[model samples]
Target: MKIISFGVNNFRGITGGLENNTIEFNNSNTIFLLGQNNVGKSSFLKAYEFFYKNTSAAVEDIYRMNPENVIEFELVLQLDEFDFQKDSIANKKEGLKKWLNPDNLLKIKRVLKPKIGAKISFEKTENYTWDYEQNGWVAKNYGGIGLDTVFQAALPTPIFIKAMPTEAEGEAIINEILKQKANANLEDKDRLELKEAQAKIQELQDKLYNPESIQSYKEEVNKYFQSLFPNTKIELSEKDKTKWTENSIGKSFAIHFEQNNNGEKDETIPTSHERIGHGAVRSAIFSLLLMKDVAEEFERVDNRKDYIVLFEEPELFLHPKLMKQLRTLIYKVSETDTPYQVLCASHSPQMIDITKEKSSLVRMTKHNEGTRLFQINDEFLKDSKEIKTKEELKQEMNEILRFNPFICESFYADEVVLIEGPTEEIILRGYFNEVQIDKDIFIVNCGTVNNIPFFQKIFSRFNIKYHVICDSDAAEVKELDNYGLIPFETGIQKSIYQQLKSDYEKVDYSVGLFHVNVPTFEPSHQQESIKDNLKYSNNYLASDGKPYNENLYWKDVLKPNLNSEEINTVPIVKFLKNIVDHN
Candidate 1:
């Protein structure tokens, strides 16, 4: 079973004020949570952990703000034949299989309303009724095994890899696997009869420590010792009595890292998991998770185990190059024969595969108003296949990856300014600097006028209000690249901003999309609205065979003139400022 959708209410940050929140996931794809800090991204992942890891979480734990308050959380899962076949899953399959919705999906709900107020548990969501006083769900099928038995026993165990102590996590993971192996060996009577072996050891001890010829030696010796010294009487103890048990052997193992570089007979240097670098440790842990999940899936005879790995800020301590490698690894592992799902809560674009269709992306945002989430529909993903063929898409992705740090920088910024081509990105960055506006506004190169929607969708998904500046490539429309066209969309909008505002109910796009009222962005841009003299200055500055720097024109321009409305650059600055101010 894989998560199809998750809903939470009266949980932290999301509901100390907000009303309700739900994040629906796409199956068989990477589900990315894109948002700024303090949003429901982490809370959403925690819901998965709570439901799977701590099914019996206390009432006060989940609804910590108030134990008496009602709390509601729901999970919709896409099930398969294997889900019903497993014993633990089979037990819980009662009353649930019949409850599968029209889509053949299972919706399990946890609700404590009107004061059941004890602990977290599984209850059938089938016949639940709303209680106005408690303002939460009241499950009709109370105190039952609707979907309880499949908690990691039959369902995919949810694992977390946050931005802390990754090496130690790896160590813990390795130790647990080793213990599981040891316990299996101790319990498998067909492989090694532990009880019989314990009996044989006892016989051997009798021969060595107790003289079998003198049958009553232990009793006779104890009696004599008791007479000699009442409290100091001795008894023969078997040393290996507990050796063959699972717990005894499981506790005996420990992992150590040691190395000796010199060829000379130097003492080996021993080290703990702490010595490893953060990136190395994170990579190691991630690799181990991938390997183990795949192995677990394949090794299972009856039910294939599906594992969902959660990573929060996966790019925390890694370089841009490493981020790309790690992102690629996530997709590769999910695509393997192993049944796996990867969820990432990230603020770094490098950690996300942007080229992948939006169905894989979920945008989360929080504010005093409330937290809202939006995910792309399957229609957009299907439409993209026609827009770019497989080979072309791969090449585009590779090129975008080359500038991972620069491309993904918008994710970290407070405001995003998405413009067509590198020229606009450079110009806007220079323009922002020239005016000396100290803002966390990042300019993203959208590459083409047609591609404006592709990026705007991403920005809006993360709840980042973005202002788009695109060239009116009308004259070159036939020759221009086609990207902004989605399936549900009939044709290109005369004003993409108007279209965007209509398309999404979330963002107010009145000032978001700004199409330069000109034919093109180069000479037309220099001639029209702004009449930028920098274009002339750039030509004069260029002398060598080398190309002119896009940012070079602004070098000699003073800040005061750029700020002055009388100056030529004011229109551009004001336009950029309005985008920021409005948001």
Candidate 2:
């Protein structure tokens, strides 16, 4: 079963309606939740944990701690033919026939209500599965199966990792994973070895057991039992079937660390779990998970399809290098043979990869109504198919990330400025930093003017307020050494400018689009003295057959022209300020 999406309402910090609170997996295995602090990103992960656990809700679990608020979670899962196979469902199709929709999708809703009074407790939360025939939710009860059992079989178990993990938490996770590995089916060779070992152990137990003494003890225990209940009797037996199973042996598993000091063979030290640092323990837990998934890639042990990892701040307690490695492992688990889906709430930009096709980026913000989720690729290239193919856009975005992963910082911003290159970015950033002291506007360098529309498509889809600034080059171009004429009405520059203009005009939200008017940024300034300095810089650099340094252009030419007193009055500075102020 694949989780398509889940919705939450009145759960903890999330009080939005079901429609606004919905998070779509979008057929992606890796979903990232990115936002500022207290935007309810962790709340979403906790809500999933709540759904899978189906435990009683504390009074604070309700939105605003209101008794009238009902915490609701709805999960939409897609089931395949394999899910209908007998191995998955004991009674096969008959057992799940009632819960499946026409498309074989299952929608399950869990609602929790708080009971008010001095002795506060929660009312029993019922599991309601969508009934295809009734076209609404009905209590899902398969024969005498418990609600938790039904869900355990139907959905993947959610492994929720909360932030601020301790050594004990890491040890607990390791223990559970080891148990899971032990319970999984073994190889034929290993199975044979274990069976032989078990048989020998049982033989020794049988030889040690005294049947006569055992009978005497059984009679003594049964004498008291018969006085009250004559029909019931107790028998103590040595059973081979229940002894030395893989899980039983697995319980003996323990993790230890050895350290060598100064490369001395004899000067080795051992460390216990409690001795390890929090970061090391957390990294060890993630490393074990990665190793398990990698092992499954070569040899799958279990047929379980429902394993969703609800991670909070996966980048916590790790170095930058390890954070990147963790991000890679996250992508690996999602792409590996194992049916593992990871939903992460992360604060690190390194944890995000907009290049990955099987990844979704969501940003959450606290609103008056509640927390609102903004999925960056919600519509999935809904607006820019004509400009670039999906693959082309992804490749471009990947290249952009390769050069500058910090571009992801834009996703966390409330407003963003998309510029053509570093020159525009530097100028605008300096101006915004000095003048717009209170506003936080993120400026992104799109490599070139051609790449701005691709980013525009992304920001627009997320409904993010953004501004675009680029040089509207003259309708002409120099290819190699040959100069060619590009018609103003039918040219790439015209096309891009027109697209930006149309976007700026049609969008009801705040947006700004500005063009340099001249061929490039340096000439956009009208000051003759600054123009003279630019000319001198270009001429000096021309002797070495090199272009003038962009940094020099800013420091020597631009900054000198506009001092602190005249900065806001300058045309370019005023224009840059206007872009951000438009919000």
Highest lDDT against the true fold, candidate: 2
**What would the per-residue lDDT of candidate 1 be over residues 360-435, giving only the tens digit for each residue?**
7666765565666756543443344234464566555556556444766676566777776765666676777656
Candidate 2 is scored at a TM of: 0.77
Please report the TM-score between candidate 1 and the true structure. 0.71
Model 1 Cα RMSD, 1 decimal:
12.9
Per-residue lDDT of candidate 2, residues 1-583 (tens digit): 7888899999888877888788888568898998889878888998877776656688878888888888888888887665665253645567677777678777778777778889556888766778777898787544112254544665766777768766456556655654454334344565556566775544333332335433443454344333322333333322224346643543322444434334332223336656645555554555445544323532432344457888889888777876776787777767746567889999888888776766788877777778777675523743353534667767666688876678988887777888777666666665565553566678888887777777787776565777766665665542321111222353456655555555555534455544443566545554453334334254434443212355555566656655555555444666675765564
Q: What is the TM-score of each candidate against the true structure?
A: 0.71, 0.77
- Model 1 alpha-carbon miss at residue 477, Å: 14
lDDT of each: 0.54, 0.63
lDDT (C-alpha) at residue 321 in model 2:
76
Best by TM-score: 2
